[model samples]
Target chain A: MNNQKIAVIDHKCANLHSVIKALEIFKIDVKICTSKTELKDIDGIILPGVGSFDPAMKNLIKQDLVDSIKNLTFSGTPLLGICLGMQLLMENSEEGSLNGIGLINGTAKMIESNEEDIKIPHMGWNNIEINDNNNSRILNGIKNNDYFYFVHSYKCIPTNNSEVAAFTKYGQKICAVIEKNNVFATQFHPEKSGIVGLKIYQNFLSFIEIGK
Target chain B: MIINKGNILLTKRIIPCLDIDKGRVVKGTSFLSLKDAGDPRELSNFYNNQGADELVFLDITASSEHRNIILDVVEKVSSEVFIPLTVGGGIRNLDDIRNLLNSGADKVSINTSAIENPDIIRKSSEEFGSQCIVVAIDAKRNNNSWSVFTHGGRVLTELDAIEWAEKVNSLGAGELLITSMDEDGQQKGYDIDLLKSIQKKVNIPIIASGGAGNLKHMLEALTIGKSDAVLAASIFHYGKYSIKEVKDYLNSENVPIRLI
Candidate 1:
């Protein structure tokens, strides 16, 4: 089946089911590529993640796929990250002493509230206010303040606010979506999200608009 | 408390319980091969515009790393749909309920959190009012007893879901989002037995979830299952039956429903 190949980067510790399911709901072609060997010449790459930052980074390193991912991103190949995938695009993650992919300079830290009563995991559905004034193709099908499903405790705080394409509130203000050229990341899962999340994939598919 | 957006209460709510990961909705058969159901924002717009009464967004993603719903996504959808959205999964405390409501969610549902900290229900109800607190209980038949599963049906808790429903009601929960894990996605129909049992035990409105394939199932849920409302993902997600179609069928079947 030679479909539009979208890889749920098999970086050892990743949630491939929901991402693959989202692509399937859109009827787009998707595959689970656990290794760089299977990700040659793909239409686009979807790097998804869950769980801890240190273990996730360790798994990515153990598989020796980080360099390939960087190469792919540098080559201008379209790539997207969800949740931990989004955090990996940052410069460093304070959750674990590991530096991130550094694709975008940002810091990911725990959700802290001076209110003295906010929970840590900050679970549940919340509204995502779109920030990209340019309204790039990724946000084409979505509108400002459309709620998407989110599940994360720590979130990336982009130092460069310009790179913040979207933002969400969790105790303190946190980065929701980050975009710079071919690289884009959403702290929320478009795959597991409802129709709004599907629109993100549809937009991404349209955003790439080309096969590798 | 009084209601406005949720006041008239939807008679035929085309509610979709989204299975979210990362932050998107995921639907699958038997909890596998999850597909892009659609963007939550776009889908919410379509549903809200499509004459839907309400929306239910479930953060189906496991919170092993303490994941929370993306507020931007919620704000975006709430701003567009202008409809009440009931959000659930990994809700731990009253603060979570406050955050969700502040982020534009109309109602917040609790599962394992209620079990781990039952006091939260009382606290949340007192702070946010019972109307804003929804208790979602996932029960599966086990050796002649129904058991509640938490953490996205990954962990089977010791609490008897049916009894827990009554307990939560006593704890001041306003509603119940009860699902039969055995019937979820099977499409045979809503779990009549499960709903019937819980309906007898709990006084609050019960939104029966799982095992709905067609309108007949919905009618059965209302007439026989005696559910206050019926919720399904597959039948509605695949577009096999539009919300209007289901309502029409339900009406024909003599089930009282809010018709446009």
Candidate 2:
């Protein structure tokens, strides 16, 4: 596991320090990839994002990484997206006018609540209800309902229901975790979610090892 | 544990605030008369281990000359601690917000600057997502109403507390950290009336700050005050109660808190 290299893509829209720090806790080799050249020979790729959708997509295009990342996944390299990174995996978002990476068939929509008590940003710790049939390796030891830290205004809506691994309720049944072939993403910040969140990173690493 | 029951139940956060001055954590009464607490990194680690949902570090003396000192503290603590960290004090513009966020601060709280230039909240939030911009409002009782204070509570503004809460929310602040000057350091309890009024107007989460002397005070801040989170310094910094003790108390009362 120590010899395996994991590349975290830097699109100028996120603070990659925490993600790198989280991955380093397991003694794994982590690198920040800005362009396609830095992504060569990587065992796994992590796309961590913050900020808006259009700017995130624009940053990927500005770095000339869109094609490289898309091609890398086509070759069966495992990819994991976090927060805005998860939304970038969808086809597009209502927050902005840019097209997403199209890795998953879905659209990102604004989370609205008619009740005044329910906030819009949906910030704080909330538990997830794992899909009973979800045997995804990324959720290996995670329980059915465990709290994880979340801070976002938009929720991902994958077109295929089977692709969703977990869901959390706010005003509606928002997708919290999604697992498709060679791709896994979470709408919450696992790096800031504490021990249970650390378990998620551990499970992702173990999945990478098995793929090798 | 809060049963899902097909509903999203977000646990009310119990946060330990560390007021940093000259690179050391300090606590004070009504934003004056400071006393040393401990090292920022040590206390942050202590809180994280005790299952604190989040942490807030306010640089009480956030002068231009001492800016780098707080950045250094944020860098060191964020490297070791995993939970969300919010750093406030002397945040003047977008560059200040960017610098803190780049240094690993999950959120940046601005009070004086936001009052000085209300546009900063909108600009900063637009540049770096609303989830990272937290507006800290210092309120003092003015007869039957509350007036907003800035500059460590030394300067008072003409803006009304309740109205300012709604204005900041419209300006794109992700959360509000409201510190009541009247009840701060008094140890009786949070200013329930102040929190209740602000919580009613804003859609963003409100963190009740100041005047937390015991566990029940913290509970009142969450339940009656309707704050999404509670921020206390003296109680936690002085060892009056550990975070676990408070969580255990709130848990028994069924407040839906995160218990490790």
User: What is chain B's TM-score across the candidates, in the order shown?
Assistant: 0.91, 0.96
Per-model TM-score, in order, reads 0.53, 0.96
lDDT of 2 by residue, B1-260 (tens): 23343343588999999999989999988777889999999999999999999999998775678778988999898888889999999888898888899888999999999999999999999898899999999999999999999898889899999999999999999999999998889998999999999987888999999889999999899888888899999999989999999999988887888778
Docking quality class, candidate 2: medium
Q: How displaced is residue A151 in candidate 2, in Å?
A: 1.1
Most accurate candidate by DockQ: 2
Model 2 TM:
0.96
Please report, in order, the local distance difference test score of every candidate based on alpha carbons: 0.73, 0.90
Worst 10 residues of 2 chain A by lDDT: A132-141
**Local lDDT at B124 for model 1:** 85
Residue B163 in candidate 2, Cα distance off native in Å: 1.6
Q: List-wise, what DockQ does each model earn? A: 0.02, 0.77
